[model samples]
Structure formats: structure tokens, C-alpha cells
Target: MISFVIKKGTNSNEMRENNSSLITANLLDWYKKEGRDLPWRETSDPYKIWISEIILQQTRVAQGREYYFRFIEKFPDLESLAMAEEDEVLKLWQGLGYYTRARNLHAAAKAVMDRFNGIFPSTYSDIITLRGVGEYTAAAIASIAFNEPHAVVDGNVFRVISRLFGITLSIHSSEGKKTIKKIARSLLYTEEPGIYNQAVMDFGALICTPTQPKCVECVLQDWCTAFAENRVGELPINDRKIALRNRYFHYFHILQNNSTFLQKRNGSDIWKNLFEFPLIETPLPNDFSQLVKTDFFGELFGGITLFSVDHKLAIKHRLTHQLIHTHFYQMIIPEEIPFNPPKNIFKIENEMLSDYPVSRLTHKYLETI
Candidate 1:
């Protein structure tokens, strides 16, 4: 029934230290009773921890669970992953989107093997040097695996810190991020940094969720400035709008003599190194007749004089910042015709289709037939 709020003069060394201790103690106690039981939290192995971290990025915990298990089963240790082929790694990560993360995981594994003699880095500085590792992931690995004193400032932590201190800055801004990071460090439980880090993250996930948070039963409600000011939802401000672009892709699935044609995506585009049916991207949606008149369609089927379109499928795939409108055209070329595809295009037996890794959209199309 009492009200508690952290006001100005709270930035003083003594006041900050007192508030930090109180927050740490309360968070750890709450975590002990309400923290979610997760597989990644059970181990201090950097390999497993690193894998879980990458998989969880832009992916939900429920979805990431199976991927974490499957990936660890396939490549249990750093040595196993470093020696494995990129195709193998990508194939294992087929359904999971944001494929660049998987590639970076593989690359970082090789770096650890070659640079650190197969041992994972124990410090934040060294871990951040690996491919694809940012400050957050590096801090997580250092604290959880090595018991180092580093505060993790993930989305959860950002929200919790923002609301607790009543920060008015947009989380998307550099100044707001810097302020949150400073506050996170001040509140970190230095003695058990790993436990404290996970505790705060768990608190944010379970009690201080993004929507419909359980504020009534929240342990930090007394000290939550947003709660006192009736602005819980407005505390963690992120007003940046994502600019989404639309792309149209016409995919040709050429079937001939029990074989199909596929091309590995190259260059600095999405789905790089992944295999899919021969594709031509257009600015706007093009029908079958309009498609045949394009330069790409001409170059693709230049050698073949005749072919029949047996089936057509259209799919709209959505990404974080792009909306992909894909059309699949299945063409059956007679065995008598000698077809010479482009140099980048390669022919593979139908049975070998599943052996190559494709994007999620391609995988869905494959499931239909």
C-alpha cells in the first residue's frame, strides 16, 4: 500500500550503490521462484550457449528450442562444426530464417578452431572478435560461461530498465541506448553476474512482457516509476518505422529426364549461397505471357525451342523488411531436346533436391510436390 519512486539525486555514488543492491537482491529472489526452466540455462558450455543465442535472435523461444537441440546433436562441439561443410550446416538450419546467422555461426566456429586452437574465448573482448558476434552476445557468453562481470542489455533488459527509471528517450536512439546500458551496469550483481544477468532477463520476459504485462503481481512494482506514473506501456519507447520494399520473383522449375535445374544464390543479396529453382526478379508482378517476353526468360530458355507449362503456383512471402511475391512455373521439356542452361545453372537429379539448402519459401514450394 506504500509508494516508492527513485527521484533525482539518485545518481549520486551512494544512492546508486544502495538502489543497485536493492534491485539485484529483489530480482535474484524473484528469479529463484519464477524463472522459466530452459535448456540453454543449464549449461556453461560456450559452444552450446553461443548456438542458443544465435538461434534465439529474431526467433521465439518455443521455435528455437528444437533448433537448438537439433543443431547441438549434429555438431556437439566446436571441432565438429569447424570441420563440417557449409552446406551441411545450412541444411540443418533450413527452416530457420535469417540464414546469415547460421553462416556466421559456422564461420565463428572455424575462427575459434584456427585462432584459439579449438577453445572458445572466455572474455567479452575476444568473443566479440568472432564473426557475427555483437556486444550483447559477447557479454552473454563472457558472463554466463566465464562468470565475468558484464551486463547484458537485450530487449528485455532495455524495457525493464526504461520503465524502472522512467526513461523518456526512444530506445532506438543512440543516447537512449547509452543511458540504458549505463543503468544496466550499475544494477548488475557483480558477485554472481551470470545469475543476475539471467534473472533480469527472465524478469523482463515473464513479468514485464511487452504487452499485457502482469503488473499486478510484479515484484518490482513498488520501485517501477512507470507504474507509479501510470505509463508502463509508454516507458520503453521505440517509434522507428520499418521501411518495407516489395520484390517480384518468377521462378522456373524445369523438369527434364528425371532431373531439375537449380542455381546457388550469390552476391550480397538475401539467401546467398542457398539453392533454389532458376529465378528472374521483376519490378512488378508479371503473368506467363509477359514473363516470356523478358530478357531473363529469354536467356534462361534460349537453347530450348519448346516447353509446356504444366503447373503454376504463386506465393507471397514476408520478411522483416521485404515482401516477396513469388510465382513458380513448372515447365516440362521433352527428353529429345538438348538443353544447355546458363553457366551458373546446374542440373541435379530429382532425388538430390533435398540435399541442397533452400530458403524457407523454396522449402514450402518443395513441400507441395
Candidate 2:
């Protein structure tokens, strides 16, 4: 039999009213038997836990595992990561799509060093002050690292709680959030919150998954309201749907001798600070012939009269809110022509291209040629 102590809310009456104690106990039991043996779970260090959590955001566990290992090997602690440069950090986080997370991690590491005297904050209040540390992440770190009884309400928790309670409110609504969070708080087994948090998260991940939940074998199935009502698939209602906007990019990979021009992306846009070939963005997709005739195209290569061009097949890259249709063009400029590119763009040796961090879209194009 598993024990549960309600950290918040009224008392045993509230526990019995919601059957939270039983739910929590069964969840912990399920976790003990079926929980994943992830590398992050083996340690109690807040720094490492923070790393694992940030990496796992917008990244699959399988892919993030290797990145985590490599990242830890390079910058093991807050001090190490704080001292390191942004470029080196970005380079290490090359293939990770959400570059902003890496940047925030780097910034947060420096913050930990400056604000907390190189020590990771123990309390949720202090931890949330760090960059990229939201309520979910802060709760995770505070509870898992310092044994603070802060219930983590991520997508997994949302799904599991909604199904277990057979919630019908839209998850996007404030009422839904309050209801789910309240239930989560009530169900948090406060005796060993670190273990309990991990258990609930593991139970959600392993048994009550998003798409194809193993309800038949789930320990919580008997207690699950959605299962009892035969509405498991429809309980967790989410009304938000992303409307994707399309943009077209024509990247010019101009080569003069063994060197090529690569520019660092700037501004508050996608792929900021990452290196890429000179790009001309258009409202709609355009072919090379149409692209060459554009005003922006002429401004870039107005003086360069003698050049050979070879266009590659257009590639479509999809992101959360945007769809990018990218076209890569390889141009060979003559050695004698005074080719002056944009001030932001600098010439780099073709052999040294791998040194700088680039977007995955740019990397894929590089791999082809």
C-alpha cells in the first residue's frame, strides 16, 4: 500500500471526496513498475535537471538524450555554462530546432551565477526568476530537485488529469486551467513530492498517453472518469488550432575560389544569430528566373555581371506557426570581379562552414551538396 499526504487544500475529507489519495497511490505504484529509466532521473542536481527539462522541451526524449549527454560533458554546471560563449553553446545545440531555448538556457545560466551566487535556486519563487524558467519548468525543478511540493502541470499532466476526471472544459480556457491545476494540487503526494511528481509524470507518459493510451492495462483505468464514461478520447478538450502562414526564401550560396559568403541572421525573427547564406525572402514562391528579376536580387548582385548559377529543388520546412519554402541557388563568381556583398555577410572558407552554427534547413541543404 502506498501512502499519500495532501500538501495543500482542506483535509482527508477533500482527499476522500476526490479519491485523490487512491489515485496518487496507484500512480506511484504504476511508476515504480513501469517508469522509464532516464539518465536525468538518476540525479538530484538542479543544474542537470534544468538542462534535461529545457532540452526535453520541443525535443523528443530519444533525440534530447544524446544532446543532454554531450551538453553535460561540455558544460557540466552553471559556472561552466556561464563562462562559455553564446556561439559555442549554439554550436553544441546545432540540430535543436528551438534555438531560443538554448539562448535562454545560456542566459539563465549567467543569471544563476549573477543572481544566486552560482547556486541553483531551491525554491520555486526564486527558480522562476531565471530566464526560460516558466511555472511548469520552475515547478519541475523546485519539486524534483529540492523536494518542494509543487505540482507540475505540463501537457502530460493536462491530458492525464482531464481524462481521469472526465473534464469537458476547453484546456485553453482559464476555468479549465484552474480546475485541472486544482485537481493536480490535491493529488500531489506530499510525503515524497520528488518521487510523486516523477510518478505522476511517468504514469501520464507511459499509460495515459495522448494518442493511443493503454487504458486496458492502465492501473488508473478503474478510477479514470473518462474510461468509466467511455469518453477517454474526448475528455481533454483543446480548442486552439494553429494557423500556419507561408513564406518563400531564396538563398544564394555564392562561391568565389574556396570561400563563400555566410551571414548571421539578426532581429527578433526565426533563426536569429545563426549563420546562413544570403537570402531574399518573398511573399510568394518564385522561380530562379523570377527571383533574379526582383529589385532585392539586383541590389545584392547588381555589379556581378559574370556568374554561373545552378538552382536546386525547392524544399518545404514546416514549423509551429510558419511554413517556409526554401530554394537554394549555387553561384560561382569570377575571381577578378570586385564582388562586394552585404556588410552583415562575411566570406568564410568552404572548409570552415561546419564551424558555425546553422539552421537545420540550411544544414540539410549543405548535406545535399
Candidate 3:
């Protein structure tokens, strides 16, 4: 139960400035001894830092670290990523869940090569112009790689700042964002903005965590308003909640000889550009008898004689905003079936199916059967 007392007759601005200096000095001193030894911290390359920052978004450092190593190993540099095909890049990023990040990385890499003549953009303006590069990412790259004095306001920083300042405003609100950004900028160490930013982020991640924050061991505990006021759990509020929509997916795994049929998803829906078994989405989970009577079922497997049908496998996969309940129906047919499939549908040898990148739902089904 550490406490801080402000001296009498001190101006608000002076008090704030003193607190800011205290936070920066104490945080940097703690960071010098406590910061995690991340691979990205070893380099000043904007490309590597950009990759790490992108990978860390909505992902934990432990999980993102392996993915980072894998990505770097496959595509060693920006040129390698730029030269790679979209499918190849997505394949490498298959299990990472957010396919759009991989797509944007590929696009941004090409933009660097084509638009910037293979040179990584140095200025914040040019970096933010690239696809999927937002303010936080741009700030991280600029500060870490170029020593730009732009303050970063990520989830970690939000927690640390909100608690330290005893802010109860919803961080998702515009006013909250403005307040957090202003405070972060005011407290930023201009001489070593990169180290200061990383130090603050690390302090939040390792000390001021969302659950069971290490207040007892924290260097800023005495100055942390939330900690002193016993409101650590209540600060840094977020009112925005995700509304998940339920979707039913009926996947048809039709096999002929040693090959299985797969369809490439098109358009701007979930799992776009990814391969999956021929699908028939329904309003609800329908029985096989009801499914077989539909026009879609007849058109897909009309002439082919069904040797076997297994309707036991059902998978409930939860995405960021959509909860997909997928049921895989395996239909075995003869080798010389005369049924013609759609243009997007093609037969691939069962052994070679692992080569293509499939959605997590499809991957779950494949792993089971």
C-alpha cells in the first residue's frame, strides 16, 4: 500500500511535469534491468520491426515470437516477401488466424518495392500510407527504427497510463484516446524515444498486466493512482464489446479414388482465397436427408453413386466476430463418376491436400479425418 503526497502551493502543470519525469526515469531504470530479450530489439531495421509489430497485434509475445521466426526464416527480407506469391505468403501464415495481416504484409512489401523503389519508407507519413499500416504501427516503426519521438499508445500503454493516472474513461471512446495520447506524448523521453516507448510497453506487459498486475514489485506502484486508490482492476475501461454472429457450414468432402474435391473460396466473405471442401451453407444445421433433397445437393452429386456417407463430424469454430458451426459430410464415390463440378472445385490427391492453405475450420476437420 504505497502512497504519494503532492506538496502544497505546487502548480498543476509543475506537478504533472514532475510526475512525468518520475515515471520516465523510474520506468527506464526498471526497463534497463527487466525488459525482455526479444529478437526484434536486436536490430534497427524498419522491415524487421514492422514485421514484429504487425505480428504482435492481437497476439501475445510468446505466440508471436515463433510466428516471427517462421516468417523471417521463410521470407528473409522485404524483397523475398515482395517476390513471393499471395498463396505462398498465406500458406506460411495459415495458422496465424488473421489472414488479412499476411495479405497486407505482402501488399505493403510490394508497395515498398514498386512505390518506394525497394527502399523502406523512413517518414511516418510514407509508412502510414502503406496498406494496413496504422498510427500505432507507424509510431512503433518510426520510434524504434528511426528514433522518431512519436509516442506509442497500444493496449499495454493504455493499461499502464490509465492505471497510473487513475483514469476511468472508456479507452474505446475518442476522448479517452485523446487523453491517453496526450499524456503519453507528454511523458515520452524525446532523447531516447525508442527505448522509452519499448520500456513503457514492457512495463505494462510484465508489470501492469490486465489480471493480477505485479503492483507489489512495480517501480511505479507508489505513483500509480489506481494502485494507491485500490482501483487497479477498474481503470482503463473498454466499453466496446464484440457481437458474434452464428453461422452454419455444411462441408461436403467428396472422394473419388485417391483424390478429394476442394473449392477455392471467392469474394469478400470469411476465409476468402482459402481452399476448403465443397460447402453448402444453411440457415441452420440441417439433416442429411433434408440436404440431399435440395437442388444444390443434386447438382453437386447427382450422377455419382454414393458408396458411403459419414455425418458424425461436427466442428464449432469461433472467429473474432463469427461463430461457425461446421459439420463435415464425407461421401465416397466410385473412381469413374460422371458428375461435373464447378469451376472453383477441383480434385487433388489426398496426400497433397496439406500443401494448400485452408481455414482453421477446414484444418480442424482435416486433422480429425
Candidate 4:
């Protein structure tokens, strides 16, 4: 029953053409001669590779490389990351916005320790089961680490394959994903899926770039429809992105006995594994003076030394569809939080503060203090 339906959707006509064979060979040859010497590219270690992949998710190679090196120096392996302090992890991830990836790496490290016994899951599905893993990440890790035959369909892959094959499917559409996945998988060389995958990704990033791609120099230009048709700008369709909603965050750093209370974000959202001071989110900016007078606000900073800093820094943190304007209040009080303070408010020491991972926005507050 499933076979008949599968036959209708599969694109076996392209599969039978055998066009990608020489293209794959030429591209791999080109990759061997021209590939960049990246740290992650040299290693087969799953942890290191996974870290690089996640860091590069919404970040560029150059910026992501700095974080990758910095992170590796701090936590060299899964055990170190698993045993590290939350603040320590966040601190390591400080400048690299998207604090959640750091937290997830930490959590996934712990998962590897507890469930996988400190060994990274080697299979495609097993790794995907990790806390923050998505399909694309799982595929990359699986293929790169264990040479699993799963096709990695990341942004680079979407762009390269969609344009090369002249597929007009929107890269963001459900059917488009299926179409690209089938094509990429069909062309994947089972013996060297990892190398092939990396080649295509690099080709897209450097040669098949989104703007003014160097098609004449591309080895795949013969098979690339966008090059032949001279429509390089039109292929690899993308759905119009919805506008990002503005979010205003105001944190009250209540100090009592030198420890500032913090709450870990729960559930599936941004900054999931990171620590933060008490947060009060609003649709728009509020009066800074009135913000400090809330019931819990008054108690947390009671006996205040008249040290209430407002809008100390403003940062625009962009997510997929949300743009958060985060601000921190650098206030100081006794070591003990007031009784009327909001629930879940804890205390942290100034020196010990560097041991936990706080959001990049939050890190700015710590740095200035």
C-alpha cells in the first residue's frame, strides 16, 4: 500500500540521469584542492563537530570559529561540559548571542553522560533525540561522526541543491524539503557522505553564494540549472518571513548578602538552559521609575543603597520571529533578599558569578559591574 503512494512522489527521473556522478567527482576534487582549513573540518570527534555545527546554526563561520575555539578551551570534552557550572557554561557562551545553544550543549553533554554514558550517540536518530537537536543538526553529526547515510539539509544545502537542479520549490516549504531531501540523498555517495556533504556546503557558501555567484568557475556549472539558464538569482525560493515581534525585558538584579537571585528559564523557548535575574517582560518599554516600585521589586532591593541603574544597556536580540530589546537594572542591596520579593529569586556571589552561563545580554551587566 505504501509502495504505490511512494512511487508517485519520488523523483526517480532525475535519479536515472546519472548527471550528479561526474559533478560529485569534480566537486570533491575541487573541494580537496580548495577547501578551507577549519578546526571542525579536521576532526571526527562528535562533541567538537556538534559544537561547531550548533554554533554555526545562526552564525557565520568567522564569528562562530572564535566561539568554537574558546569553548573547546573551556570544556574539552562532554564530561567537562556536563560537570561545568551553569554560569560557567553561559559565561563561555557570553558574547555568542542565542544563549540557548550553549545551554543545550551543556544539557546534551549531561544527557550523553547519564543516558549515553558520556559517549555521543552515533546514529542519526539517536543523536536527534538530544534536547536541542533538529533534523539538520542530527544529519550533519551523524554523517560527519559515524558516516551515517543521512542527508544533511541545511541552509547551504537548500541553496546549492535547489539552484543546481533548477528545482523551483520554496526552500522553506514542506514539499520543498521533501524534494531536496530526495535529490540530495539520491546523489549522496554512500562511501563518503560526510566529505560530499561538506563539499556541497562549502561550494554553496563560497562559490554559489547568494549574490553574484561565481558560476563560470564552478565545476558544477554544467549541471547547475541556475547557471545554464542564467537565473541564478531566481532559484532556491524562500517564503516571505513574518515580521519580528518586539519584546522588552527588564531584569531586576536584587542583591542580598552578595548573592543575586536567578531563575532558569523552563520549557521550549529562547535561553532555555541559561540563568537570569528575575525577568519582567512587557510589550513595550515602561517608565523606568515605576518599574522599580513593583511589590516584589521593592522587596528584592529593599534597604537599597540608592543604586538603581536603568537601561544601563540596550541590545536588540533577534530570533526567528522575535526581536527582544533587553535592558538590565544594575541595582545593589544587602546580601539577603527582602521577604516580599518575588518567588524563585535566589542569591549569587559577585566572585562566584563568573561560574555560571548567563545570556549575552545578562553578561553585559556582569561585565560592567
Candidate 5:
């Protein structure tokens, strides 16, 4: 397979011919002076770039930088990441709230080994085919790593472009997405697409901020439709308000002797491939009194009688599109595995459970107890 040819010269002027002449020049000039000195930005390695992109997506750059350095030091190459144990990976990603990103990083590493013989794919299409590589991520990798002249229309770009072009379409709307994508692609300067893409993203994040953008300092202030029309706050329109789905998770901290019943998640959802206590999720909150009466419950707590009910802890967590309200019921059980909780919930030593990648709510409870 042919690899992307690395650029041998620095030429920002020629690339500006395709985009809004004013915006391109100003954006690149501002980036050269004010762009954050990110470790990933310093290298062309797709592996490092991919890791930084995933981390930054879920966290602010300041907070993500430390983790980025730590993670890179850990699994520096794709082979190391592929060979690392899942528990070790999760432990490295412990404080990072979105555990799915860590899981995908590991999965994609293995995928690269099995599919591409361990080398990271170089083209936009190949990168997009990897796990967790969406259009935005793919565009970033392709342009940043291989200088593919594709545009990355993330939130920052959405805000900048909507206001610059005076577009009134809701950014979340299909029509809005179509309009912005077309314009973004057209604006992509193919000659130095990598630098051009980075400049626009950096310009949007730093200058075209969500609130009180510095229009006087912006290069294309005169051409900006929203600014000219005195409606900078309303250009990047969005209509969708996420409806939080309330779920009642009753985690039976079922103890049989000194052991507890736990299981790792198996599906393609948040908390997937993580471990958790035996959980009973009801649409609405479950009545604790009735739940305790089930005969199967006896199998879990055979030796120890129910002491006082521990204080109930309620926690809320959000996923891509789901909100989880989890309630923990901590119980004391003996050392033996109970027969009642099926194989779906595996029996494990209480002391060793820390190695499992449990949910944040569960992690909180475990930390306290």
C-alpha cells in the first residue's frame, strides 16, 4: 500500500486560495502565535495523534495533557497496547470518566494487529474503518497524519463556520450538517491541508469562543455574517435537547461467605467489558423490601443475617444518549459462592474486585467501603 507523501516545504499562501481569503490568512497567523503546545501537535505519529484525539474529545486539553503523557509512556506503540491486559489498560485509564474510549483504544490496537499487521492504517477510509473512529476522528487522523485534504467539523468548527458564513440552520439538523460539511470541504486548502485544518480548529477554540468572541481580533470579522448582522450568539443553531433516560439500577452487593457475585459487561454499550455487581435494572425505582424476599436472594447471603440496611447512595451518570441513575445496596456475605445468582454473575473474591473495570458509581461506592 502506498503511504501518504510527507510535505517538504512550508507554504501557507498557496493553501489559502481555496478558502475565504481573509479567514485563512488570519486563522493561520493566529495559530502560529497562539496555538497550544500539545505533545500530539508536535508529532506526525498517527498512534500518538489518535490517542490524544480520543482523550481530548472527552476532556479539556489542560486535564487531558497529563493523562496523555502518562498513557503514551505506558503503551507507546500499537504492539504494546495490543499485548497489554484489559485490566492493566483500565487501570491506566482509571480516572478518565469515559471508560468506553479506553476500551476502544485497546480493541482498536488488537484490530490493527489482526487486520493490518500492526501498522496503523494511513488513509482516511482505512482509519474510519477502525473501531470508535467516527467521521470527525477519521478526518482528524487523515489530515493530521497523512495530509489528506478532508475537513473535520467538530463542535469548534460548527460554531466558527456557522457564525462566519451567517448560516442559520440548526447545526444538529441534517440540512445544517449538509450545509456546513459542504462549506468546510470547499474551504479545505489541499496544498497544506494538515496545517490549514489545525489552524481553523485552533482559531475556533481560542478566538471564536462560545461566549464573547473577540471579533476585533478575528481576521474575518468584516466578512462574518453573524457579526455583521449583530447576531453572533444565534448563528450556530441547535434544536435537540437530550432527554435523560432515568434507570433504576439495584446492585445487590450479594455476599456469599467472603466472596461476591460480579460479572463483566459483554455488549457494545457504555461500561461494556467492565465488571459490576449483580444488577437488577427496572424502568422505575424498585421497592427494596419486596426485592429482599425473593428466594434466590437467600443463595447470596447464606451465612450472615441481614444487619441494618446500609445507607442508600444515589448517583447519576450520562452516556452518549442515556442517563443512568444507579442505586447501590451494600450487603455482607460469606466467603463461598452462592448457587442462586446464576453464572451471569460470576463469583469473585471481594479483595480482588478492584482490578475489574466497574462503573464510576460502583467505583465510588467501592472506594468508600
Candidate 6:
């Protein structure tokens, strides 16, 4: 039997340490039998592992699996990725939602070629220097690929650690992350940090899930403080709530002589570098009559004669922190060229629009026409 000496005002750090060891042992043992046979787990190739990690961010395992294979089939290796154009990379990642990840992945591939001689950096410090590689991603790659003893503290790890230890701190807070990182490092099985990290993540995703956890089958249930205290649902706290801002978009699909106009988004705003129709953003949703009265609309179609204007189609696209209500208007103009077009605006054959990488909203709109 384990016993603890109660010193007045002293913390129970020693007892906690002992519990962590037990948790680690039981978790790893359970993992050997129950861990999912994921494709990334079967290889130690840092490039493959890095691709899986990037694809898995904000993406479900089932969805990410298909994209992983598609990406691998397309790029094949770091060298292939580095030589490919950014547009080609984004085209492959068209349906992946987060285009920025694809962009950063392409950028990092080139960086690897230029800085590390086309080989993935092996150390934690070197891996973290890659574009869009944060602490969680760097730790994951370093530990899993290089067998480094860095403990990964991603969302899964955070949930598992918080519930097992009954930590009520907000996971979004800096102090909470630091505390969890400390606990994760202590519990990491240094002998096989790769397997251990994957095991913990699988345990959290399969057993200690966000909702409707399978507590009865969990290996660490006996020692899980939250389970014993009946606080499994309440332990892992995230008090930060995202306030979504609303934006209105009016997209004009101008067609003349079997050709349409599209412009590439160029700014720090969302969907940067993606192609879209001529856009008129307004403070609020406006009808065609009101939209045409605006000065921007006059400048856009000043010298052109419209043959017909189709009824507007509206789409509501939701992002993490923004709600976009887009109104798409189709306009057919005369074939004769009259005035100079807006900057970045160019004409493309209607059939060739599919060649461009467009936002999800634009893709959805294209499917209709």
C-alpha cells in the first residue's frame, strides 16, 4: 500500500509523481494492444510524419487520411514538393479548407532544401524553425521522427492530463499550458517517447474523448482523479470563447463571349492567393438595386453593357472567428472590349475556371453554374 506523510502547508508533488508513473505504465501497456494502426505510425520518415501532422491539424482522422494519401501520391517526396509551384500545391489542397497550411508546407519544403540540404531537421530546435511549425507540431515531429524525448502537449494530451490529474485550469491560458507541459514531460516514457506520445493521444481520442467517453474500458480509470471524483466532464476547462464577426461579400460573375473574369486575392486577409470573382464587400447585406447604386459597382462596370443580370444566390460560409454571408450575382456583358479592367482582374475561359485554386465558397458557387 502507498502512504503519504502530511506536512503542514507542503504540496503533494511527490505523491503526484508516483501517480504519474503508474499512469504512464498502464497507458503504455494498454497502448501496445489497443493503439490504432494509423499509416503515419507505421513509418519513421519525418517528411511523412510532418505531412500527417499538418493535415491532421483542425481536421478529423477519417478526412485527413484520404488527403494524406492524395498528397503523398502527388508530391511523393520533399524534393518533389519543393519543386512544385504554390498554385499546384494549393490545388491539391483545395478541399482541405485551411489553405494556409498547404502554403506553409510548401514554403517549409523549400526551406528544408535550402537550409538543411533537402533533409528534415532532426533536432527540436531545428524542426521548430520551419514555417508554420509551432511547439506542438515540432514536438510531435521531433519525438516521433527522431526519437527525441520532447513531450507533445496538443489538445488530446491537454484533455488527458487535465482529467487524469483533475486540473481545472483553463487550457487556453498560458499558465495552464505550462503546467500541462510540465506534467506531460514527467509522464513521458523516455525509452519510447514516440510510441508513448502516440499512445496518449490515441487514449484521449478513443477513451477519454471530449464527449461520451468510454470510461469503463479505460486503462487508467482506477487512478484517474477526475473519474474517481465524478468530475470527468468538468476538469478540462477552456473558458475562452470566440466571438465571431460577421462580414458581407458581394461577388460578381461577369461573363462575356464564353469567358469569365477572376482575380487572385492579394492581402493579409483570409483566402489570400486564392482566385475569386470580382468582389464588393459591404457593411451589411444589400440587394442588387442597392449594390448597383454604390460607387464601387459603377467603377467596376462603367463602360460595359450588361446583357442580363441573373438573380442573386446567397451562401453562408462559416470560419473559426468569422461568418461570411456571400451574395453571388451573375452578369452577362457584351463581347466587345471597351475599358481597362481593374488590377489583378483577368479573363479566363469558363471551362478553365477549374484550373484555378478557389475558396470553398467559390467552389460551391462553381458547382451550381
Top lDDT: which candidate number? 1
Which residue pairs overlap in candidate 3's backbone?
none
Indicate the worst ten consecutive residues by lDDT in candidate 2: 2-11
Judge candidate 1 against the unseen true structure and give its global Cα lDDT, from 0 to 1: 0.88
Write down the RMSD of all candidates, one decimal each.
2.3, 3.4, 2.6, 6.2, 7.0, 2.9
Runs of candidate 4 with Cα error greater than 4 angstroms are 1-16, 114-118, 253-264, 292-311, 332-340, 365-369
- Higher-scoring candidate on lDDT, 3 or 5: 3
lDDT of 1 by residue, 20-60 (tens): 67777889999998887989999989999999988987788
**lDDT score at residue 4, model 4, on the 0-100 scale:** 16
lDDT of each: 0.88, 0.88, 0.86, 0.78, 0.78, 0.88
Better lDDT candidate (3, 6) = 6
Candidate 6 lDDT over residue span 21-69, tens digit each: 8779989998999999899888899999999999988788998999999
Residues 34-123, model 5: lDDT tens digits? 887788989999999999988987788888999999999999999999999987888778767788789889999999999999999999
| Cα lDDT tens digits for candidate 4, 21-93 | 6567777898999887899998999999999999988888999999999999988999999998877887777
Model 2 CA lDDT for position 327: 92
Ten residues in sequence with the least summed lDDT for candidate 5: 1-10
TM-score of each: 0.94, 0.95, 0.94, 0.81, 0.84, 0.94
Could you tell me how far off, in angstroms, the CA of residue 239 lies in candidate 6 after the best superposition? Answer: 1.2
Give the Å shift of residue 201 in candidate 4.
Answer: 1.6
